[model samples]
Target: MVLIVLGFIIFIAINVVVKNNPVAAKFAGAGRILALVFILLGISTACVKQIDAGEIGVKSLFGSIQNDIMGSGLHFINPLLDVKKLDVKTQNYTMSGVNDEGNKAGDDAIKVLTSDGLEVTIDLTVLYRVVGADAPRLLRETGEDYRDKIVRPITRTKIRDNAVYYQAVDLFGSKRDEFQQRIYKSIEDDF
Candidate 1:
């Protein structure tokens, strides 16, 4: 906007203010060309957006989220729109028994009470990603901190909920697959 305004000011000063000066009249054409260049440069920069690989763009216009998303590439869009880039590549979150292994400094593994009243400590790693088509809604509803606010709490809760259905020994050996499948199904539905 500043560029466009400055361009117009230059054009007016060259053509109107200096029209009567014989010495300035010789350079008026060059000043006019420079003014047009500034106007074009501002418009081009404002309308073009580039999204990096493994990322998607969520566009919002005048603070309202748009339903559509932009994939990795250059896009021509409205000058007034704001774009937030989100990575679509696979992401991993871990809860581990060892300190420094999980996202937190302490032992972050899940502890749950089994049906037989035994305490079970489980180390879990969850892999997830954002879908391009839902990026706008996800951004609007969850914001950028979806990892802590949404993913972590929900995963821990669902695992604990499913753990009580099996004995501690079964969760570690025989019914381990079943327990994992049940937890996955519940979390998938909620997500």
Candidate 2:
């Protein structure tokens, strides 16, 4: 947008100077050429989008979403549209009380009420990624910060919902795997 405005200003100056002086006429032509170059550069740069590896591009034109998901590489798109990049790489989020490297800490740990009316604190790690094909839909529904808005909320909710089905002791002992699997299934279904 800046480039387009700069080019227009230069074009106007070129026209104003062309009729005033013969000596400045040559410079005016050069100014016109420079303006054209700037405009072309702006348009060309905007039209070509580069999506990095393990990422997808979600294209939107005038706030309306386009269905196509751009894969990793350079793609030609409408110059006026906006392309938002979403990482498709598998991400690991740890929910824990102790702040470990690459893990989220503090009160983010899951707390749930068990069937026996006991409260339990569970630390969990979620390994997941955004589906490349669903990037467009995800962007349309959740915007750019889908991980915080969707992934965290859904995972936390599902864990709490499934936790109440088992005894607190079972959740920490023999039925651990079953509890984990149930939570996983519920979260997976939402995605």
> Candidate 2: worst 10 consecutive residues by lDDT?
98-107
User: What lDDT does candidate 2 reach at residue 167?
Assistant: 96
Best by TM-score: 2
Task: Show model 2 residue runs off by greater than 4 Å.
Answer: 16-26, 99-105
lDDT of 2 by residue, 1-191 (tens): 67877888888888888877778887986899999988888888888899999988888899988898889999998889899888889998778766553355456688889999998987778889988888788878888887688778898899999988999889989999999899889999997
> What's the residue-level lDDT of 101 in candidate 2?
37
Off by over 4 Å in 1: 1-42
Q: What is the per-residue lDDT of model 1 for residues 1-191, given as tens digits with 9 covering 90 to 100?
A: 67878888888888985667878877888998999998888788879999999999999988889999998999999888889999999998999999989987799999999999999899999888988888888988989899998889999999999998998889989888988899989988887
Clashes, model 1? 0
lDDT of 1 at 124: 98
lDDT of each prediction vs. the true structure? 0.90, 0.85
- RMSD each, Å: 4.3, 2.6
